[model samples]
Target chain A: MQKISPLRSSIEAFNKFKAARLNKADKAQKTNQQSQTNPFGITFKGTVIQMDVFEKAEKVNENTQKAISLKEKMQNTGKLLASAWVGTINKFSSLKTNAIAFGNKIKDSTIAAAKKIRDFGNTKVEFDVFKYNVSRLQNKPVSELRTMLSNELQGVTNE
Target chain B: MNNKRVKNIIEALGKHKDEESIEVLNELGTNCPIDEIREMTSKALIRKNTHRALELMIVNKGKGINDLSARVAMCAINELLALKDKQEAIKILDDTINMHSEKEVQDTARSVKALMSFSS
Candidate 1:
């Protein structure tokens, strides 16, 4: 109700607003501190039970690592078996091809040897003697030739 | 013993000029078990161009053109046709055709004579 200037009254209202905001900020900080110290404000008085939770977690981690290593080893073994199987098959194929080649070589050599033997038989000394005897008979006496030829023919017929 | 040797012997006998050679050819060459020997013998006889060889070829049974084997028969006929002096062969063929007892031999001689006339 007292008379006041407009600027002075606005400044007084701003100061009152600042003081109320400061009071609210102080009360929020005190409540935050109280929650950080003890939120429910209750205490446990009996003997506390301790569990080895971190140890169990560490054991779980070690088991997971062991399982991962075993899986990797199994994969490696499977790859090794597949490669060995392929290598064995390739070896067998090469062996079979070599065997066939060797067999063919033996067969060809045998045939060549047989042909050489036949040629040798054809050019023997006895065959030349038979030829010479046939040519020599042309100059012999007719009666002697006839008797010789008759005997030869008789032998041939007997055979 | 060897067939090649026997064949050469037959060829040698064919060149001999003696009459006894004919008898050997008739006995061994014509009557041999082998057909090739018989064929060679017939050709040899024709090459001799003698009356006796002509008689054997034209008048004999199962000899020369009348041979049992058709290949031998054909070879003998071919030999007769190929003769440079066919006078003696023609005469014997005429005798066989007119006077031979066997009708088969007479017919064969007649056919051969006809072929000879055509060739000349």
Candidate 2:
């Protein structure tokens, strides 16, 4: 029987997870398009404007917070994966049963952490599109946009 | 406390756009001592009736009123003007151009008039 390697399975799972998250972001952007209207009344062909200014500001803040938390988790997970790899190399055969089980657990968790980081990247792409649309549609000056964004951030935090 | 109450009332009236709300908003917008309250009333007035809001905004466009408030008022007028009949829109813009001293408001009213002419 050909053995399915744990590393290969984890890699496949991670790729599938990343693809799902990217698809979710695309779907969210498509759904939000109905509410967004071009201020000039001329819709640019194929230009997607999903989030309004306030929502865009809030989403950016949320994505930043999530990314920071995931970074911390990934660092911790990296340490655990490294220790598990060392154990597999040094303690293999002597504690083969226990080492493989521990190594698989570490691999699962590391893939989960990697999926979270990729999800954050997907959300960041949505946020970038939102920012571009706000600039294009509203035609607000940077100072005004900054002031409006700060006001929205404050409103979100206060709630 | 009283100012907040007035602000809340203005918001409710503006949202409802009742038959008599325009008059009340116009009075408050024009005579209210507090700038914040006055601006609130001006916005409410604009929301309640852009035509009436235009008259009130033009009346308030003089020295003491806030420039921001007048700008908002002008924007509302321009939008409502588009929906109004051509003659009525022309009359309103002519009156605004003649009676209003604010160059920005006058320029906008003129442009609105020209746009109406070109569209018609």
Candidate 3:
């Protein structure tokens, strides 16, 4: 007799979530690579402004590169924030982060990422769990995104 | 989770809140579970029949009103404050303060007065 596993179900769900996220990341990276690769000299604010313009864009823009630039830069920010909070989110997988209730399996292992994810929590979760992936990624993080941008400005100044 | 309890709260909003009724009704619009009671309470006060709202507050006597909790109280108080009827809020709040004892509820009443003063 075959027995169904709830634990397996959650794990499968989690795995599927991870794969989709990575696939989105791949598409974003491909677009940016296709656009223009900035070898360590990318201005964070420039990317932020571009993303802001892309976000406010209701339809396709005259410049597809601008859209991809925003999407790619945002992916970079997401990874950096997640690295900061990996600790707490991994510790408490059972508890749902109020900020990002559905999207982003917020374990205790990651705080900064989860918080950033939560800052955009309203848009972070999958609408149909697989139907529409990363659509909400367009909302953008105003605060952390600004901070990352300001730091990039500092880097530019020193250069 | 409990729809049945919710219906009862809507019904209570229609009636008077006695000691026994307020205790049970207080549990409706909070972490316990959200229900139409929140919507109904706000709606009932909007009619602005100050005479009736005050009557219910006094009749209930503040026994289990704390079970009604702070947020609901604050919401209702804000409505009353909007109508610029401090007497009604003051009457209910002071009555609740004298009869019942909860720091949150007390603070809400105090804040309402502060807010009203600031506006004036």
- Candidate achieving the largest lDDT: 1
Candidate 2 structure quality by residue, lDDT tens digits, A66-126: 9998999999999999999998887766688888899999999999999999998787354
lDDT of 3 at B18: 34
Clashing pairs in 2: none
Which whole-number lDDT from 0 to 100 does residue B105 have in model 3?
57
Worst 10 residues of 2 chain A by lDDT: A134-143
Index of the highest-DockQ prediction:
1
- lDDT for each residue of candidate 3 in A1-159, tens digit (9 for 90 to 100): 988799999999999999999999999887677445444434665552233433555776658979898999999899988976885676566565544664554554477777787889677564443321222211333332234323433343354
TM-scores of the models, in the given order? 0.52, 0.29, 0.26
Which model is ahead, 2 or 3, in terms of DockQ?
Answer: 2
Question: Which residue segments of model 3 deviate by more than 4 Å?
Answer: A1-159, B1-33, B55-74
Among these predictions, the greatest TM-score belongs to 1
User: For residues A1-159, could you state the per-residue lDDT of candidate 1 as single tens digits?
Assistant: 988999999999999999999999999887666555454434447422233322455454788899999999999999999999999999999999999999999999999999999998897556546543756877777787777667777787787
- Which lDDT values do the candidates have, in the order given? 0.83, 0.58, 0.48
Ranking by DockQ: 1, 2, 3
Reference contact recovery of candidate 2 = 0.00
- DockQ of every predicted complex: 0.31, 0.02, 0.01
Q: Tell me which of candidates 2 and 3 scores higher on TM-score.
A: 2
